[model samples]
Target: MIYAQILAGGKGTRMGNVPMPKQFLALADKPILIHTIEKFCLEPRFDAILVVCPADWLSHTQDLITKYVTDSRVKVVAGGSERNATLMKGIRYLQETFGRHADDVVVTHDAVRPFVTQRIISENIDAVLQHPAVDTVVPAIDTIVQGEADAISAIPVRSSMYQGQTPQSFNVKALVDAYATLTDEQKASLSDSCKICLLAGQPVTMVRGENLNFKITTPYDLRVASALIEKRA
Candidate 1:
């Protein structure tokens, strides 16, 4: 089975007073979460699509899905305080609702990243068939620096670094097992799911992602996404 889990748990603290979370913000003619959901619906290969939203937004998210999304495969669930925990919610839901399978693949994405393409989704689904985990990335065009609050510590080789993006697909059982190995402290520090796999000593294969597939976090990113949408329109 192939599942698409949309992580919409974030509070969008960096987006200032947006009235709603970043995922609920309007991008073009639809909400960002709806835009993200459409991409998965476009593929049709996903056996189930799970939208993981904040506990407070559970009904609101379901309303959005009902209003804009016609696909019957999608369902909504309340997310946890953190991204990893939210992901586990979707995974566990999949297990409870559909039962776990060794060959099942779960493609988890950030709902605020509305620009993810059909090709990226399809590629992740395809790549996960060969490798246990697959992550979408784009090469860093600028030189990356490691820094402290007051100083630039070191510069990493540009060729060796890539910015990780999502629709990070993995074998469902493997991902669940990786999370099982984490301590509470380690779980709190997790910023990305690929890191969890790496921490568990699993290899993550990379797929080149489009530059437009950026997450809408701050006002600057919101403006950029709006401009991109207007330009596309």
Candidate 2:
């Protein structure tokens, strides 16, 4: 069975004055995480969803689920301190509850990326089915330049550059095994979950992503997201 794991453990340090985590904050009449969860829940291909949140936010997250989702297949579990740790915890739970032999297609996504459309989700799922080593990423659109300190150093071609985003879909066993091998230093430097699979010498295939799926990290991001939602609505 395909499972969607939403990582919602961020402390919203960048989004100053947002009383709650960015994911839990209201956007377009609902919590941002709920919008993300609802997108996957609407897809029949996803059998279940696992949301990883900080331990202290468990009850609040549960309340949001009860209000918005109401799907019995949804599970809210306490998350770990770091992003990778929280993801590992969610993977362990999926393995124990659903059994390791289950179809093993796992999609790990950022809870704050509420605008990820169903088309993107389906495209990534299809790619994973065909390519054993595949990840959903969007190419860098603007010109690329490398800078050092306060000056431009090099102008690298943007043709081959892409910014990574989630939901990074992978075979459950493949991802679990890759993450299991991460060392303390490796985990510390890991910025995204897909990197874990790549560090294991796995090639990641890219799928186009919506610009609106950008993560809400700061006040400006929240403003942009809110504007996008308003524009779409």
Candidate 3:
């Protein structure tokens, strides 16, 4: 079974004046997270969806899901402190509630990336199935610069660098086992789920990604997302 795990536990501190978490804020006529969940729900490839939200926002997320997504396969679960924690929570919940094995595919995604298209989701699923040793990633388009503050230096590269985006698909068992081995310091410093896999000496591959899959983090991002949605509409 293919499960879509949406991580929505952020506090939205980067959004400054935005009253609520960026994922809970509305874009187009619905909440950003609702739009994200709806995308996967409409896709036939996804057998189920698990939304991970802040512990305090669990009820609110449930109410929103009830109102927007009618899919019986969707569920809401409380999230943990960090992104990895939230993702692990969703993974465990899916295992317990759905009785899915570690071999099942879990598509981990950010809730604020409302514009993730069905095509991207499908491609990720296919890539994971074919390349179990490599986690798929989309190629980066912009030039990459590396270094400290004012002395920031540009690293010249012949090959294009790919920026990582999610719905990063993984074998459920591999992911679960990876998390289980994480050291306390590693767990404390890690941010995204893919990072955990990376630190575990796992190889992440590249998959082509769309520009629309950009995550909403700031007020300006909301404005940009609004414009993109309007254009698509």
TM-score of each: 0.97, 0.93, 0.92
At residue 198, give the lDDT of candidate 2: 82
Candidate 3, run of 10 with poorest lDDT: 131-140
**Arranged by lDDT, best first:** 1, 2, 3
Indicate the TM-score of model 2: 0.93
For residues 1-233, write the lDDT of model 3, one tens digit per residue: 78888889999999998677889998999999999998888778777888999999889999999998899888888998888778888888888877966458888889998888888888878877665423435565666778887787777572667677787888888777777888999899875667777888776666677877888998889899999889989
lDDT of 3: 0.82
Q: Of the pair 2 and 3, which is ahead by lDDT?
A: 2
Best by TM-score: 1
Output candidate 3 Cα RMSD. Answer: 1.9
Query: What is candidate 2's lDDT per residue for 25-116, written digit by digit as tens?
Result: 88879998999899888878887799999999999999999998877889999999899889889988998898886357877889998888
Judging by lDDT against the true structure, name the best candidate. Answer: 1
Query: CA lDDT of each candidate?
Result: 0.92, 0.85, 0.82
The TM-score ranking, best first, is: 1, 2, 3
Candidate 1 Cα misplacement greater than 4 A, ranges: none
Residue pairs with backbone atoms closer than 3 Å in model 2 (clashes):
1-103
The better-scoring model by lDDT among 1 and 2 is 1
lDDT of 1 at 121: 94
